[model samples]
Target chain A: MVPAPLPQQLADLSDLVGRMCTHAAGSLQSATAALLECRERLALQVIAREPELDALRVETEELARDALLFHQPVAGDLRSVVSTLRSAGDIDRMNRLALHVAEAVQRRHPAPTLPPEVRDDFAEMGRVAVALAVKAADVVRSRNVVRAIELDHDDDAMDVLHRRMFEVLMDPHWPHGVATAVDVTLLARYYERFADHAVAVARETVYAVTGEEPDAIPI
Target chain B: MVPAPLPQQLADLSDLVGRMCTHAAGSLQSATAALLECRERLALQVIAREPELDALRVETEELARDALLFHQPVAGDLRSVVSTLRSAGDIDRMNRLALHVAEAVQRRHPAPTLPPEVRDDFAEMGRVAVALAVKAADVVRSRNVVRAIELDHDDDAMDVLHRRMFEVLMDPHWPHGVATAVDVTLLARYYERFADHAVAVARETVYAVTGEEPDAIPI
Candidate 1:
């Protein structure tokens, strides 16, 4: 049996994933803005739009299966297909978390801002998420190894900010039993985890480019 | 180009995944027993054994890549690898969580057993985790379709037990504060998520046997 070339199949799958990632990137940025800017309508949109991400997941997986079965392409082609299939789900999950943050923002009834320290972290996390998504989208098309690695820095920045945010909320100095503290904890977690998935995408890119899992992100 | 027989590569990769899964099952069961029985000594063993699981993951992925590149396997092989990759991570994460439980147990002064209400849930979860691991192992060796599909039930049972445990713990009457509540929440999450990974393995089995993802897992 002759095997079909895999580059075309993988390219098609990558293209689709890239577009959906764009949607995901857009959704998260919008969701974060809605939260910080007090746009209830936008937050509602983010909450309602989660299904789109799920849909992309199902569709991407199906397409990848079809490609894998049809081509049975060896080597880099197979790696790309498998990686895209798996990474799509991870991206969708992160998108949903961003929407969840937007929902929480809605419930807070638009006080117009997060507490000063917390808001700074949220803003930083949101920035990192958007940049990470853009870099992820970029790498699939170019497979630029160094560019792929850059996304990890964005994730690192988010982690630094998230840790600072968590520290303040969890501090013993903070009055015990504040409801806001709990909210802050969950919020920081959402953003921090969003960064984590972004880091995962960066890892996948390294796998795609180098044919090896790079060492754990630099300290 | 003459390709290797598709079935041969598929069988080989699937078989490798199944064996590692079986080993993981036994180790995880022991890991849980180590925790619940206050066997910190065993816990250390569990912690020490993680490298094996990681090795299994790397091996499974390499095999999956081989199947894809060499034979251009059809739907079933592709799905198996996809599912195996996902499940392998799940298994590793569960191992990590079990290690976490062990560490907590070691640090704990042993004031009391886990609450009676949740103790049953924990025990049942542990039992089912072991059972699922065993069944998944069997699926690997024999490629039994029935056992593969039934993997869903093991996962469902874990989820129900976990949710019930949380509901009980969260009741104001349970007398837990922020710290205690966080502990229970994290523990419950660990088990719930472990079952989820097991269910994922079953889903792969179904995909392998039937070449289709399960439409629904019976409650």
Candidate 2:
């Protein structure tokens, strides 16, 4: 088969990145829900789906390399190709965060990881994470710098939720046992870091578009 | 100035990567000591040194691209050049982890982050992190696949230490409050991730030499 035109190649690359983001976001949402709701089947499904994200990352990187080597595209074209690689790395980390959530759920099995006291906090964090993931995917698809900047606001909410969870953990009258405290800390971090990666993708997306880091405060 | 020979250029690239690894390892070691010892000055020093590591990564990437474009290296040479880029990413992450450690220490200054009970554990974890960073730098310098594989053992010990720290966190009648628990969890994770990044560098080094992954288990 003949090689596709440069625009077609770029389009294919963009499409692949979008798909990867979709997979990563879906897996993260499902995994977080599994942890909160104790859905073993969904948790297992999330675990099984990790390799797909890994494959997408590899495919995107290879395509980016081939585009660079063959086309030797310069300026914006070069930035787009490089951004594909950088974005793939960010997406892959998001996927890994999703897998960790799944594994946390799997480790706890029938018992829910979040106890009743902190359950609402984790639920809110999960909602924020899912929202960020969805927005991150959109940013990858559209490269809308403004929308990418908006993700920072969403990520801020995640941070607030994370801190609230810590408040409950550190309360003098905290009821949960140490095991539960450990679980909560890890669970909160998973959501917080998931949001952080989304913001990272957005930052890189902005960089790709404007060829400079967006004005969003550095993480 | 005259351009260097192709082999000389490759050697220079390797030398630069080795230096990055050294700086990354040194920064990690200093940061961990500063954290365990509650040395604000050293922590500040670690934080200040971060930009140098970031600059090194950018320089390494530029050199790799220049080598790829100018020399058109192929086969093992090409693999080595590509590995430089990949290894640099891993090393850069290790440096970031160090920065996080320093920042943690700085964040909790005037009072030790680790309480008396878990201080020893954190100290040991810090030692393991430093050892792994040193070994990682050596692997980058020598491209010795055997030594690279050995780094896995160091990582395994880090994992064990992390688990032991969790055991203390989960124990009933734990004395420390929730904030300390949070600090311990974050501290353990920082060390664990630092080790993981070292293993990633080792894996990339092994791949650079053998064109295939070694028998070491994936992180």
Each model's lDDT: 0.68, 0.80
A1-219: candidate 1 lDDT, tens digit per residue: 553356766777787777767777888899888877888899888888888877777777877887777766556766787778667866876787788788787887756536655676687788888888878877766777787777776677887887687567656655444445545666676777677776676667678766785444352
How far in Å is the alpha carbon of A40 misplaced in model 1? Answer: 5.9
Question: How many collisions per candidate?
Answer: 2, 0
Residue pairs in collision within model 2: none
| Local error of candidate 1 at residue A137 (angstroms) | 2.2
- The sequence of per-residue lDDT tens digits that candidate 2 reaches over residues A99-186 is 9889988988888877889877877887888788888888888888899889988788888888888888888888776787888888
- Give the per-residue lDDT digits (tens) of candidate 2, residues B3-62: 566687788778788888889889888987887789999999999998898777777776
The predictions' CA RMSDs to the true structure, in order, are 4.5, 2.9
Model 1's chain A TM-score stands at 0.88
**lDDT score of residue A27 within candidate 1:** 83
Q: Locate the minimum summed-lDDT window of 10 residues in model 2 chain A.
A: A210-219
Name the runs in model 1 displaced over 4 angstroms: A1-7, A30-44, A99-123, A161-170, A173-188, A214-219, B1-8, B23-31, B34-39, B75-78, B99-121, B139-149, B173-176, B215-219
- For every candidate, give the share of true A-B contacts it also has: 0.38, 0.38
Clashing pairs in 1: A72-B72, A74-B69
